[model samples]
Target: MEPPVPSKPQFSLPVDSDHKATQFRLFSLSPPHMLAFHLAWLSLFSNFFSTFSIPPLLSLIRSDLHLSSSDIGRAGIASFAGSIFSRLAMGPACDLFGPRVASATLSLLTSPVVLSVSLIQSPLSFILVRFLIGFSLANFVANQFWMSSMFSSNVVGLANGFAAGWANVGSGVTQLVMPLIYSLLTNSFQIPTSTAWRAAFVVPAVFQAVTAILVLIYGQDLPDGNYSKKSKRSSSTGSGKNFFTVLFTGLKNYRGWILGLTYGYCFGVELTMDNIVAGYFYDRFGVNLESAGALAASFGLANVASRPGGGVVSDKMGRRFGMRGRLWGLWVVQTVAGLLCVLLGRVETLWGSVVVMCCFSVFVQAASGLTFGVVPFVSKRSLGVISGMTGSGGTVGAVVTQLLLFSGSNQFSTQTSISLMGLMMIVCTLTLGLIYFPKWGGMFCGPSVEPISEEEEEDYFLLE
Candidate 1:
C-alpha cells in the first residue's frame, strides 16, 4: 500500500536577505521544500540500506559462503572502492541532469544489485557483486547536493545534517531490523535458511524502486524546476562544457580538499564502522547475531541526534562567530572523535567498548555535519564538484584505512586499527586548526560576502 499524503505546505520568506528574518522551528518545512527533503532522505535511506545490507548479515554470509574474516575485510574494500569513482561521476551528473534524475536513476539501478546478493557462490563473485552494489552508495552525493540546491547557505548546514542524519538513520535501522526479518522468513514461513537471507534483500529493493517513482513524480531539481529552466533565469547559465568547466574550477580550490579529508575522518569512519562494527562484536564478544547487530547499530544510532545537533551547532556558531564558528565546530568534533577512538581502542569490556564507540559515533557524525556546513559556502559556483569530491573522501578514507590495517591479516583485530585511525584523526584536526586564508584576513576572519536579496535564487553563494 502507498503512504499517506502530508498536510498542505506553508510558504515563508526566502533564506537570504539584508533585512532581519523571521524565525521558524528547525525542519518546519512546507510543500516543495518538505517534499524535496523527505524524498532526498528516502533515496539515501534506501541506498545505504542496500549498501550496508550485507554487514548485518555478515556472519551468516561468511558461514554460508565459506569466507574468512580477511575475505570480509576485502569485501568491505570492494564495497567502498565501487563508491569512490561512482561518487565522482554522480556529483557532476547531479549538476547536469538535476538531483532528482541522478538520485532516482542510481537508486533504480542499485535495486537489482540489492537483489543479486543472494546469487553469490564464491569469494571472487562475492567481492564482484559487493563492488557492483557499492554503486548505490553514491546516492548520498545526490541527496546532499539536492538539499544544498534547495536551501540557502544560512540553514543549509541544518538541512544537510537533518537530511543526512535521518537518511543515515537507515543504516542503524537496517542493522536493527533486517535480522529479525530474516529470522521470521526462515523460521515462521519455513523458508530455507539460505533462501531467507537472499529474500530479505527484496524489502530494500522494492522500497527503492517505489521511491524512485515517487521522486520522479514529485521532486524538483531546483526550487522551481530543472537546470535548463533555472539556467534561463540564472545570471550564470551555460552549456554542458560550461558545467564541467565550472565543476573543475571548483575542484581547483584547496579548501574543498581540507574539508574533504577532514570529512574522510568523520564519514570515512562512519562507513568503515558500518562495514565492520557487527563483525567486531561477533569476533570480540562471541555474541549471537541479534546482539551483535544491535551493538554495532549503536554507532549509527547516534546519527539520529548527533548529525542534526552538529548542523544546529554549526549554524548557531556561524550566527555568533561567523565562518570560524563552523571551522571551530569542525575542529572540535574531530578532536573529540579522535580522543574517543583512542579510548575505544583501550576498552576491554563489552559494554565499555560499546559505550566508547557510541560516544565516538556522535563526534564523528557531528564532524560530518560540520564539514558540509562549510561545503555550500566553499564554492557555490562549483558546489556539485565540491560536494562530490568531499563525498568521495569518505570512501577514500574507508578504503585506505581498511587496506592499511586489514589487508593481509587473517583476523580482524580492531584495536590496533582503531588506534591507528585515531592518530590519523588527531593529525587532521591539527591541520584544520592551522588552516587560514590571508585574503579573508586571519585564522578566524569572516568571508567578505555581498548581500543577497530574497527572490533571487542564484546569488546565495558569495565569492567573498
Candidate 2:
C-alpha cells in the first residue's frame, strides 16, 4: 500500500494581503509576528550585551592582564573577526534550520565564552576569549531575517528598524550596566578591582544563556509555525532555497554586495564606536570610568529612536517613490552622518565633542536602519543570505576601520583617524546609485514596463 500523501502546510494566523503582518503592536505577544519580533530583538540584545560587556571594563582588564596598546587593538579586531565568518554561516544555517534554532544555538554556544572572561591571564587568552564570544553576534542575521519573514513590505522597514534599534539598545545598556556592576562589586562589596572585573562578566553570561533557552522553547520560525512542525516538502518550499542555493543566490546578486559594502560604514562604524567610545571618553577627556560609560551610553542610546526613525522615513519614501525613494533617503542620511563624524573629530571642547558625537550617532545608526530598509527588497528568495552578507559587512567594516585607523601602530591621532574614517564613509555612500530593482527602478531612473516576477511582486507590492 502507498503511504498517505503529506498535507500541505497551512497558514492560519492573521496577516496582510502578502501573508505578512500589517501592524506592529509593541506590547502584543501574538505568535509568529509580534512574538517573533520580541524574541528576535531580545536574543540579539543579549548577544550584544555579551559581546560588548568587556569594553566598559577594558581599562581594568588591561591593567590586570598586563596588556599593551597593540594587544588591546588586537583583541578588538579579534572580536569582530570572530563575528565575520559566523555571520556568513548563520544566514545559511537560518535557511536550513530556521532562525529559532540558529539564534538559540549561537547564544548557548557563546555564553560559556562570555563566562570565560574571568580566566584570561595573558593577552593571547583575552583575545581568544573575545574571539569566541564574538560568535554570538551571528544572531544578528537571524534577527533581521526573522523580521523580514514575519512583516509585510509596507511596514518591513519599521519592523526591521524597531527590532534592530531596540536590540541595539543592548550595546548602550551594557555600557552603563557593566560599569555599574563593576562599581557595585568594587565599592559596595569591597572586592578587589581585578576580581570585580572578572566577576562582572557573570551577569552577561547568565543573561545570554537564559535568553537562548527562552528563544528555543517559545520562538516561532514562520507565520505558519515552527519549521520543525512542517513536513519535509513544505519546509523547503515555505522557507525558500536550501543552504548553498540561498548562499549562492545572495552571492550572485550585485545588489547584496553593494548593500554589504554600504552597511560596513554605517553599522560597521557603530560597532567600532561601541568598542572604543568608553575608552575614548576616559582617556581623551579625562573622565572617570563611570562618567565615560555614561557618556558612551548616549551614543548607543540614540538607537531607541534614531534607527527606527530611519525605517519610518524609508517606509514613507517607499510609499511615495518605491525603491528609488529608499535609495535616495539612504544616500542623503549616510552622507550627513559622514559629515557629522568629520565634525565630531574636529570638536575641541568636551561638551562640544559630546554634542557632535550625539548627532553623529543619530545619523550613523539611522543610516544602518536605512541600509536594511532596502535589504528585504534585494532578493526575497535569499533573504537570509542577503541579511547575513549585510550583517557580516558591518563587522568587516568595523575590523578594517579598527585596524587602519584605531590600531596602536597607526601614526594618526585617534581624532584624526576618525576624520579619515568619516571621509571614507562619504565616499562609500555614493555606491547607493549602483542599486536598482527591475520593477521598482533605480535611484535616478523610473520603473521599466517589464512585468514583475512572483518574488518581486511579493516583496515590492508596496510600490504599487
Candidate 3:
C-alpha cells in the first residue's frame, strides 16, 4: 500500500497578493474575521481586566480593611497561585477536551468571584476569593492555545497580536476607568466606597458572563490532530505514569526551559510593575488614586497599540529574525525604560511622571507581545505544554517580583525602593538577552517547521 499524502493547507486570504491588494482584501474579509477576533478579544479583555482591577483598589482595600503589606502580598500570591494551578490543569485539559469547552467553562466560573471581590471584609477572605478568581480565570491560557492553534502560521502572529493587544486594553480600561466608575457610582447612588468597588466589579463580571455564554454558543472547536480517542483514553487511564513520562520528555528538551526562563523574566518585571505602579506613583509623587490609576492604564494602552504592529512587523521580518530581533529589541527597550524609572524623581511634576510612566508602559507591553508571539513557532505539537511551562515561569516571576516589592517597605521612601527595583529590571533584561536568548535560539533552530494541521487551517480561513 502507498503512504497517505497530507493535504495542502488553504488560507482564506491569498498569501501572495500585492501589499496594497492584500490590505484591501483583508479589509474586505475582516467582517467575519472580526467576529472571531472580537470574540477572542473579549476573552482576552475579561482575563486582563479582571487581573488588573485589584491593584488599583489595593490602597483603598488596605486602609478600609486594615490590611498590611504582607497581607496584600499574600493576596497577590493567592491570585497567581490559583492561576498557576489552573494553567497546569488547563494545559493538558485543553489538549484533551478542546479549547471551546475549557475556555467558556472557566470564563463563566470566574464571573461570580470577580463580583464577590467587593464584598470581602477580611484579608484572608479577600485572598481566598482572589485565589478562586484566579483559578476560574484560566480561560486566558485556554484562549491563547485556541487562537494560536486556530490561526495560520503566516498570520498567527497577527491573530495572537490582535488578541493580546485588545486583551491588554482591559487592564488599561480598568486602570483608566475603574476609579472614575467607583467615584461616579459612589456619588450618584450614595453608595459606600467599598460598595462602589464591588459595583465596579459587576460591569466586567457581567460582560464576561455574557461573553462566555456567547462563546459557548458560537465558538468553533479545533479538531484533535494526531492524538486519537483511544490514545486519549489510555493516556488518561494511565496518566499517573503518563504524567511522569511527559514531564521527563518535556524536561529533556532544553529549549522549553530556556523559553520558560526568558518568559519568567519578562513576566516578573511586567507583573511587578503592573501590581506596584499605582502604589509607586502614590508613594513617589503623592499622586491621588485616580491619577495613579490612569497612569497605570498607560501600560495597557501602549501594549494594546504596539502588539498588532509587532505582529505585522514580525510577519514581514520572517520568523527567526522577526522573533529573535523583537526579543533583542525588547531587551534594549526594557533596559532603557528601567533606567528611565530613576528619572521619576527628576520629573518633579505629576504630568512629567505620567508621561515617563506612559512611555515605560509602551515598552513593557511591546515586550509582552513579542514574548508571546514566539510561542507558536517553538513547537506545534507541544504548544500547550510550552505555553503552560513558560506561562508558569512568568507567573512565578510575578510572585517573586511582588515579594520583592512587598519587602521594600520603607513607607516614607518608596521612590528610592522602586528605583532600586527598576535597576533590578535592567539587570533582568540584560541577563535575558545575553545569557538566555542565544541559548533559546540554538534550541529552536531547525528547518522542519511542522505545517499547521488541516483543521486549524480551516479555522483560520473561517476566522478570515
Candidate 4:
C-alpha cells in the first residue's frame, strides 16, 4: 500500500576503453545517441543559417531592395513574428510527429522559402520571404526534444546545451560566410552588388535541403525504434491525451510560461542582437558592412563555448546541488546578462560596445542553455508541447524587445532603451530560481536532487 517510487530516465552512451565510439564517432554522441545528436545539430544549424541569412547583408539588401530603415526593421519584425507562430505550432507537431519527422519536414518545407529570397525585388516581397523563412527557426524545438530523448536527464542539460550551442553557431557562421560570399561574388566573380546578394541565398537553401534529406533517410526518433513504429497509439494521440487537452495542459503550466520568459531574455536578446548589431555598428559607429558583420559574428561565434559551458556547469552543479543547481545556473547567468546589457547601453566606443556585446552573448546564450536544462522536465508527457511554450518565449521576447526598444524611426535611441528592457525582464524572472519545478519537486537552496527512473519512459511523446 506504499506509493510507488517515481521512475528515472536513462540516456547513457556505449563506450570503449580508448574513448572513440566502439563503432564510429561523430558530433560527440555514441551508439544509440549518435544519429540524434548529429541530425539535431545539423538540422538546427540549417534552420539558423537560413533564418538569419539576410541580417549580415542587410546593408546590401536595404540598398538593393530599396528598403528604408523602417522597412528593414519591419522585415526583422516579420521574421520574428513568423518564428513565434511556427514555434507554437512546431512544439505540438514535434510532440505528435516525433522530432525526426517534424524536423525533416521543417527543413524541406522551409528550404524553398529560404531559396526564394533570391527572387525578391521589392520591400514588401523581401519582408514576405523573410517572414516565411522564419519557419526554419522553429527547428530548435525539435532539436531540443530530439536531444532530450536521446540522453538521460542526468546529462540532458549537457546534451541539450551542446546541441543548441553548436547549432546556434550558425548565426555566427552566417555572419562570417555571408560577407565572404558577397566579396567573392562581387569582387571575384564580377557579379553586381545587387545581383550577388540574391545568389547568396542559394548556399543556405542547399544546406537546408541536403540536411532534410539526411534526417528523413537515416534519423531515428528513439534508439529502440522510430516514433511511428515504437509508439503504440496513433501519432494524433500524442502523450496519450487528446491534442487540445495536451496543449491546454502545457498552456496551464505556469512554470513553463516563466521559463519562456527566461528564454526570452537570453535567446530573445541573442536574436535581436543578431539582427540589429550589424546595423547598430553601421549607424552608431560608421563601420562598413563587412566590418560590422565581422564584429557581429563575434557575438554569434561565442555560442561555440558559452552555451555548452553553461550546460556543463548545470550538469556538474546538479550533481552537487540537485535541481537547485540547474536553477542556480540560469539565475546567475541571466542576472549577469541583465547587468551586462545595462553596461552595454552606457558604453560609447565601438570596441567597448563589441566587448560588452560579446560578454553579453556569453551569459545570454548560457542562460538559454540553462533554460532548456529545465525544459525536458516540464512534462514527462508532452516535452514537445512544453518546449513549444517555453521556446515560443524567445521569439516573443525578440519581437517585444524589438518593438519596445529598437523598432522606431530613431534607431540609435531605441537600441539603448532595449537594454533597459532586458534588465527589467531579467529582474522579473529571477524569482523562478526560488521555484522547484520537477514533478518530484526540488530544494530551493542546497544540493538536494531528484532520482532517475530506468523503468518505462511513461507515455511522453518524442519530438524526434
Best by TM-score: 2
Candidate 4 ranges beyond 4 A from true positions: 1-31, 232-241, 410-415, 438-464
Model 2 lDDT tens row, 322-383: 88999999999999999999988888889999999999999999999898899998887678
lDDT of 2 at 93: 84
Task: List runs of model 3 lying over 4 Å from the truth.
Answer: 1-34, 223-251, 319-327, 341-349, 407-413, 430-464
Cα lDDT for residue 413, candidate 4: 85
* Cα lDDT listed for each candidate: 0.80, 0.89, 0.64, 0.79
The worst-scoring run of ten residues by lDDT in candidate 3 lies at: 17-26
User: Candidate 1: misplaced stretches above 4 Å?
Assistant: 1-29, 231-241, 408-412, 437-464
Higher-ranked by TM-score: 1 or 4: 1
* Greater-TM-score candidate between 2 and 4: 2
lDDT, candidate 1, 1-464, per-residue tens = 98998753335645433211222245654546667888888878878777887899887888889997678878889999999998888878887778898889888888888888878889888998889888888888988898887777678888889889988888888898889989999889999988899889888888888888898888888755676676565645433336657677768878778777877788988888888788788887899999998987778888888997898888898887767877888888889899898888889999999889988999999898888888877776677888889999888988888888755473536877887788888887676755554323224564454544444324444341
Which 10-residue window of candidate 2 scores lowest in summed lDDT? Answer: 455-464
Top lDDT model: 2
Error of 4 at 277 (Å): 0.7
Model 1: per-residue Cα lDDT at residue 453: 47
* Top-down lDDT ranking: 2, 1, 4, 3
User: TM-scores across all candidates?
Assistant: 0.90, 0.94, 0.79, 0.88
Report residue 114 deviation for candidate 2 (angstroms).
0.1
